[model samples]
Target: MNIETIISKIKNALGEGVDKVSDEVEKSQVFEKFEDSDDKVAKILDDAGKALTSLFDTIADKAEPMIKKTKAKIYEGIFEEYRKDGSPYGETHEGFMQWVDEHETEIREKVDDGITKTRETILSGVKKTQEYINREVSKKEKPSDSVVDGSSVTDQKSSDKE
Candidate 1:
């Protein structure tokens, strides 16, 4: 559910908790935020590509095999160079996006796998932390004397101190 629906529910539940809050919530607008620096970089790269293609086409002789070969070699050198990670065109965000787009299914599967692994790791850590806290708390809580006697432990400890 959107923030508007949540606000509406809160408004009805609160009834008249704060009329101004309800009115402000009713008039509130939600903005969609994204961190798509990659997309912006991709767009710039696409513009650059168009510019390069335009330059290549400006050579009025369009039918020469040598020109075609040279263009293909240049394109290959630019887009097919293998990076340290063994991925072609992975050096640039735009090129990496292109490679990912081409291998979308594989990349998506790997991403899902990574998320699952990460979730499992987090859950394991949380469980261990919870167990550690429980153990520490149990140690600190020393079996209350109240369990044996009729009085509470705090009273027993205060009486013993006196």
Candidate 2:
């Protein structure tokens, strides 16, 4: 039965014990308090879950268009840079295939040029990084003493020992 019906039954069952009615009522009130607290906890958790989901959806919605725009800009830049020699690439898949077929030599040259430039740039950067690292390592190394004709300390010591 429902709580109110159970409470009413309890009250009726304890009729002559009316002096103890306050104790029964107190016990029921405590149980009702617990039930109310549980409902509040559940509602708070549900609200927090909904709020987090909404926040995630909002972030995704905001990012989608910007990501598309960035991708478009990168493609545009690549096309503009590579097609500077009046190439007839029309920014479509069919057009691109046709252009490739028609200007195979020019396309190959441009591709090779791009590859060469990229390799040179990477190699230059690597060389500079290596030089900087070597300089730093040399600076950190201890100075050697007792060097004769550009020989290291270990070699000199070994000769002396021999």
Winning model by lDDT: 2
Error of 1 at 53 (Å): 55
* For every candidate, C-alpha RMSD to the true structure in Å: 23.9, 22.4
TM-score each candidate: 0.31, 0.35
Name the regions of candidate 1 deviating beyond 4 angstroms. 1-93, 142-162
lDDT of each: 0.62, 0.67
lDDT of 1 at 152: 30
Question: Per-residue lDDT for 46-135 in model 1, tens only?
Answer: 899999888777654564776587567644543443343377765776876687577678655755776689679979998999999889
Q: How far off is residue 56 in model 1, in Å?
A: 56
**Model 2 stretches astray by more than 4 angstroms:** 1-92, 142-162
Query: What lDDT, from 0 to 1, does candidate 2 have?
Result: 0.67
Candidate 2, residues 1-162: lDDT per residue as tens digits?
876676677668668765555544656463654576446656776899999999989989998998798668655655664467455666666765676577679656866786689679979998999999888878995434444333323544556688
